[model samples]
Target chain A: MTTYKRMVLASRPQGHVVPENFRLEEVPVPDLKDGELLVRNHYLSLDPYMRMRMEDVKSYAAPQAIGETMIGGTVGEVVASKNPKFAVGDKVQGMFGWSEMGVSDGSLLRRLDTTHIPLSAYLGSVGMPGMTAWYGLTQIIQPKEGETIVVSAASGAVGSVVGQLAKLRGCRAVGIAGGKEKCDYVVNELGFDACIDYKAGNLKEELAKATPNGIDGVFENVGGEIFDACLERMNPFGRIALCGMIAGYDGDPSPIRNARFFLTMRLSMRGFIVSEHMDLWPQGLKELGTLVATGKLKFRESVAQGLEAAPEAFIGMLKGRNFGKQLVKLI
Target chain B: MTTYKRMVLASRPQGHVVPENFRLEEVPVPDLKDGELLVRNHYLSLDPYMRMRMEDVKSYAAPQAIGETMIGGTVGEVVASKNPKFAVGDKVQGMFGWSEMGVSDGSLLRRLDTTHIPLSAYLGSVGMPGMTAWYGLTQIIQPKEGETIVVSAASGAVGSVVGQLAKLRGCRAVGIAGGKEKCDYVVNELGFDACIDYKAGNLKEELAKATPNGIDGVFENVGGEIFDACLERMNPFGRIALCGMIAGYDGDPSPIRNARFFLTMRLSMRGFIVSEHMDLWPQGLKELGTLVATGKLKFRESVAQGLEAAPEAFIGMLKGRNFGKQLVKLI
Candidate 1:
């Protein structure tokens, strides 16, 4: 057996998570059983929904208790295999948590074939976040031709895919992000028609200019003042896919001021958990993979150095610090 | 041609419509042309949409012009006909406006065959208001069985029908009205499971008691602070049909609190004008009329005497003073 470092939740956060909320512990790795396989973590993905799980509130996902390892998705390589489905040196993606090495029973894991794409892409462009954007835009919102779509957190994992998909459907895609840098990245790299900086002054005016014909669809990720501003700009038959309200995950609830929601705008807003649409993942990945291979879709990643930097990376990502998919390199 | 007394818009009110906003004038009776019928108004249905038409702001319908007669739905008798399709005594319902007599070209009118129901029933139970409830419940909200539904302005024309239809579908129906009298009318006459009076204290507590499993469907007619209270008790997958915001119709733009709209609840809220669903009106009216004739549904009308009392009836209906469908008796 070998020893590996794992970060556990030390305390629950009140407003924003700090480095002190996580504790690094050294533990000996377990031996693989009859049905289990031993794996070494290669890349760990940090997402916004993790912040929601940190709080002790009723949510779609279970809350991460103190003294438990922080839950996340990880791309890893099998070091030893006892299961027939996986072999040694097989790259896999699973819910391996925040650890350098772990043993899995192949229950929540998928072995990736290297002939398809890079193993790291399994934690990104063809991953859960990517499928979320695909199913939400294609099935839920179902944007028609000549419609205008607005997406929040447009430079992140899910939002980037949503913008590209909107553009592919012959609709004008507008992105809203925090800083000018991410806004530029969304417009220049992701092929979004326009981008708005929510950190700048006058969100309503900016949204009015970005969506002159009024918003036909909104891919809502960040909820707060931005959500309210988008609500005001929705047309008569607008559709909204409620992906994530990251701005309210930290618990300081922002006031919503759209009184005319019951009259002026006709909206169909639906909150979606990715697990409910898991059955379509294989098909979604295949289509998204084709888009990526043909240069129709693009993705970027901001990698943190080691497991020790996971806490800071998560905090920075929440504060709009990362440029793309925030990941921690565990090798 | 003979002359008739008609009510015309003299001036637009700054806040609420009064006697001065309307003027009684004697005008030359309209002459019937080809495919035309001369109708003598027997009953005029005063509605809340007239308040919206009085303002110069853009809405679903055009604003009532100064010196032009106020537009409304009326059940009238065909006094003369230019074509052979109709006799002199045929009862019909049309967009005849606030007048004792008018000419119709068979456009925007429906002949009311009163063999199955009363003539006044066309103005109340099986006409525009009835169709509004049917389409709002069936097409817009689409409430399923075993769901808790709530309706505001519960004793009014549209809401009473909505509550009864909900009950017929095996769903628990709760209502919000103005006073104890209307609350009694909503519960006893309309067969709503429970009723809450907005004038009563502790609206939130009363709502919690009325909707123990949370509100799955909300048919909103009155919007204001009452809308805020209902937002708190909405379930995960709630549907709200924005029929009318009577509480905000007087141009009192107050901030509505809607913080719970995005995070946990999935709401499909859509505003609709009844005319938008005209293609399906025959099916809806047939179904609703069958329900009423077979004793499965019940309705009540609060009739005020004379054409000059239309403004007072409208103002009273806006303040929740009427018991049921507010109508003006012209004959």
Candidate 2:
């Protein structure tokens, strides 16, 4: 293709993200130089961390620059290559972002085996999200057999894998999700022991009921009252893998009211970004890939049809409107 | 002495502690049996954890039972002994509570050498408070040389030792305390790099000024806005040793408003009670004892004369009224 469509960050969001924060434009596909490959992007992974990068803040990553391609994870098939490492029609995964086509030097691209796993699964269950779950659950939370673990955003890409992995480790995996539909999927489909519908306005009661023995470990994604409830019920020396705080990502403050519980329970909480722990990704991906290939791990995606739908899908995902791992179909 | 004065918990505090919560009574000293020693109490240590124990809450320890002798650490002289391990006139430390005399089985008591260290120093610097500081700093925070560490309640018993020890380990020790006097003592006397007076109503600005380089380690004693301010200034992968939340001890809520920082900064926070980590006490106490004995560690005291003064002194100490280690002279 001589030209393609892409979205760029137009402006930084003041508080809540709106459509105006992004700009969709038609641009010429870049000419490939030596040691470069051109990939036709198939899918773009829209995640919570993108919302954080949209703001001008000191975080693990630099802010997504205005008038630049909005940063994201992508799985695509190489269409053309001048690089010896990558070949035409090779299924690959890289941070190709919100574009229909991308040019890369192969350094950032990883050739994938699409025979057992679908190309789309590389953007969800067997990709960064899966590795994130693996690193946080296995390394940080480290729940022992028969221990109880609570995961927030339970039906999403990361939380789903976390709960499933905990179950495999013989843990009582409890989940807290936004709605009844998501909660049902988390318990029935994803194999979580119990799932609490946080929007039911009875989170405290439901959470207490779900976790009678109290929370031994927490994979915290949505940090607010949900996180506070988990903190209140944390067992002595409980571990919290603070992976994300999507509830407060839009400039709203979500204060932890049970700060005293940290002392009273002698809890240990560690916040982490999985990308910084790249050393474990190979081991994590190997486990995740095997689980997905063996059909032991299940994941669902809420795919927006085109590149233009990326912004709205992301905004909806941030508000917990999307049911599962939100993605954009580029082709 | 056949009869001795002792204080007992008469009731639980409604909000803040009052003198009415304690009852001073004259009781006959129990006769020492085999393997027992009678201690003539010299000083009673008043600390923040006592405030939490006053409430019937599920905490690190069981609530101090009402109408029982109040729980406290005591340094005393062994005046009568039927145990082979004890001798009359030996300086010792034990949990003898708010009393003029105590009967111990010698198993709970530790003999002290007061040749260079004062007998009362065992209650403040080289005792539980000092060991608490050592465990939190060395074990949890684990600061690398030249990294900055912030200690709240910096002039108080545990906090003072933390700052001094952090400095000894080649750390930039910043302190947070109540007033100018305590702040000055922290910086000048205890050798903290800088001190922020929370009472100045410019905690944010003062903390920002004091810690130009973001805090790498935190010994959090007084949780509330002070802890929040520190959280906001935490560097990536910062470690927080949550030792106490005295500000919220009197049935008040001390919410952490900067909870988002836990994820953004990838911080690690651990709440600990020194008594629970008996394995570390020997090493911790050895370092503490040698520091005080060699004059490398300096500690001040806010002495409340006589056993009758304990309740008021404890109440005052909880309110940050005591200058340093709040102690009641019982001899």
Candidate 3:
């Protein structure tokens, strides 16, 4: 009998999640039914939004139930299949959770085309995180040519793509990251116009120096003081696309101090979820796929070893310890 | 020489303005130059936005310079004229400041026709304040038919027009006012769907009772606690047109505590100034004028005696002591 390992939510966390909160268990692989397929997960995706789902609070999505498998995106091979659509040895990607194997009826899974792009690009730039960047930039910010855009969490999965896309659209892209290392990577490697190291002192002064023309668009991720400082620097008719506030996920939500600028400068601030706009996914995927395959768009990843490392990797991601898209490579 | 009484800014107030902050002075009306017309002021418009001008801070308009005549809208008749566009004894309206008589170049003045719509209504419902209501409602909220809209400071000039216009658009109008009397007038006289007395206590409960289906649109004038309470009751994808924030204009700006809901609910909030959108004014004025001329839009006034009473009336209006549009009758 084939056996597999999977991680389940042991309990809800109080402040920061601990390893004890997730229980790694072994289970026998069930036989595939007439229309079902058994796939071995090769990789697992970890993101900041998963931190919100860990808590039983009012969020855009429902909380993760206890004893249930920790849900996430995965790319793997169809080792056994009785389904007509997915054949044995076919590669597929979907939300298959933190497990060694996933049984599917081939509904949510997408067949992979590994000829141009790697199998892992689907989880970072050409997948959910990539689509998120696309929706926020195209639908909300929609910065015009020569306009300036400031994106927080600049070296991360979603923000990296946002900066690259803005540059491609003929706009000046400024990024805000944690350290000198990440900042350097963002500016030198990612080809962003400028990258402000937020961890260093005098954030407001640094931002002012970088954006002399005033910020016309903001893609906010880290909420607290960073969001407030960026808001004060916005020009008239500035547009803000609210994405993530990972700074507050483990603690009290950040209090936006300078929202009064909304009136004085006549700003437009909107918050959105990528899942809510499913119609834009196909278009986003097509563009993201082409860019990644053509070597025009670039991405980086910090991968952990196995399913047992997902809890620690996820916790580290919230703290911004991981450099880029935090993924777990499983076999 | 013709002399007139005018209210000038004596000094900037520390917290709230008193009558001492304004000085009533008699100045000899200057001679009308070429293309100039001398106007004998009949009515002066008092609005909340004028308070923003009183402070020497960064705002949409320049600060009211001490010892200068306080800026405001006025409606009057041309007693003497040299310009062919304006004739003697012709009624006119423009920015004539807080003066009983004004000398104009006939450049800014518009001839009034009180045959169908009352001239005072031009200062209240079919004028600048009315255009503010139009631009915010149409451009930001853009509520669908049968959507619920909550208007704060509902009995005042701008807000009264907001509710009346919303009702005309086949929307459910909900008003929030200070006292029972103003609330009664808002519901009984103005034909609003419901009115909440914010002063009666149980504000949360009252707002909950009023907006059972959840607030789809909010026309926010009075920010602070009232705005916080309203934001909590808003439905997903709610749109807020941020106008005046009178509640916090005196001391400190209100801190938005529930701004995180912006992301959870996917809300779109935008702030606007009417003068900035001049292109929409003609369209807005035509519709507003028709509404008032046909008696479809109703308005009420709390007229103060003369230019000397302007400061006291304005202070009273800020304290919610006025029933409707607070005006200073200069004739």
Top candidate when judged by DockQ against the true structure: 2
On residues A1-331, what C-alpha lDDT tens digit does candidate 3 reach at each position? 3899999999988888778889999999998899999999989999877777888866678898999999899999999999999888898998889898999998999999989989888899999999999999999999999999999999999999999999999989999999999999999999999999999988999999989999999998888899989988988899999888877777566777776778888989898999899999999999999999999999999999988888899888988999988899997
Q: In candidate 2 chain A, what residue range of length 10 has the lowest lDDT sum?
A: A54-63
lDDT of 3: 0.89
The TM-scores of all predictions, comma-separated, are 0.91, 0.98, 0.95
Off by over 4 Å in 1: A1-3, A10-12, A16-28, A114-116, A254-256, A259-262, B8-26, B54-58, B64-67, B253-263
Point out where model 2 deviates above 4 Å: none
Give the residue spans of candidate 3 off by over 4 A: A15-20, A57-59, B18-20
Residue-level lDDT of model 2, residues A115-176, one tens digit each, is 89989888888998898899999999998999999999999999999999999999999999
Question: Clashing residue pairs in candidate 2, if any?
Answer: none
Q: Clashing pairs in model 1?
A: none
Candidate rank order under DockQ: 2, 3, 1
DockQ for model 2 equals 0.89
Q: Write the per-residue lDDT of candidate 3 for residues B1-331, one digit (tens) a residue.
A: 4788999999998898788889999999888788888988899999888888888976667899999999999999988888888988898898989999888887788899999988788898888889989989988999889999999999988889999989989999999999899899999999999999999988889999998888999999988888888888888899999997888677576777777778777888998999899999889999999998888888899999988789999999888898788899987
